[model samples]
Target: MVENPLETETLARLYLAQGHPEKALPIFEKLLSREPDRLSIRESLARCRDEVSRAGREAAVNEKKRLRILERMLARLTGSTPPEEEIPAAPAIQPPRPGAVERRLAVLKQMLQRLERSR
Candidate 1:
C-alpha cells in the first residue's frame, strides 16, 4: 500500500486550520523531510513551530497565575501574609443598586410587624 503525499499534506493543513498546531507539526516535518525544496512545506512547518511556541508561553503564564492564587489561599489558612508580587488583578465588581439594602430591610421589618400582630 502506498501513502499519497498530497493526501498527507492536505491532512496537515486541515490540522493547522483547526488550531491543532502540535498535531500538524510532525506531519509538516515529515512532509518537509520527503521534499526539502518545497517552499510551502517549509512555511507551514515554521508556522506550526511558532504556534506551538506561543501556546507554551501562554500555558506557563496561566500556570503561574494558578500557583499565585493557591499560595494566597494557603497563606490565609495559615494566618500568614503572602509575599507581594505580580498578582493578577481581580475582576471588577459592580456596586449594588441605589437604596437596595434599605428596601430589603424595610421588607424584613414589615414581615416582623405582621408576625408580631398575629401573635
Candidate 2:
C-alpha cells in the first residue's frame, strides 16, 4: 500500500515521540524520499535518533499519559473505545489548579490582556 508523505511524517514523529524511534525512522526515511527538501522532517528524524541515544523516557511517557487522558475524557463523554494507547500511571491534572502560583499567574495575565484589550 502507498503511504501519504504527510501522514507518514506525522506518524513517524508520533512514534518517535512515543519511544519508538525504531518504528519512526523507516517512515521518516520513506517520507524523506517523497519530501527531500523538508528540513523539519529531517531534523525530527535526527532528534528521534538522539532521543534513542539519551537515557530519557519522560517525553514519551508523558505523551502516553496525555494520550490516555484524552482517551478517557472521550470515553467518559461518548461511550466508545479510544483508538490510542492509554497510560494510567498518573492522575489527571486540571487547567484551573486550586493553589498553583503558575495557574494564578496565568489567570492574572489573561485578565491583564483583557483589560488592555478593552482600553
Q: Which parts of model 2 have CA positions greater than 4 angstroms off?
A: 1-7, 55-119
Candidate RMSDs in Å, in order, are 11.4, 14.0
Worst 10 residues of 1 by lDDT: 1-10
- Candidate lDDT scores, in order, read 0.91, 0.78
Cα lDDT for residue 47, model 2? 83
Residues 1-119, model 1: lDDT tens digits: 57556648889999999999998998898889889999999999999999999999999999988998899999999999986787569999988889998999999999999999999
- TM-score of candidate 2 relative to the true fold: 0.39
TM-scores for every candidate against the unseen true structure: 0.65, 0.39
For model 1, what is the C-alpha lDDT against the true structure? Answer: 0.91
Q: What is the overall TM-score of model 1 with all chains considered together?
A: 0.65
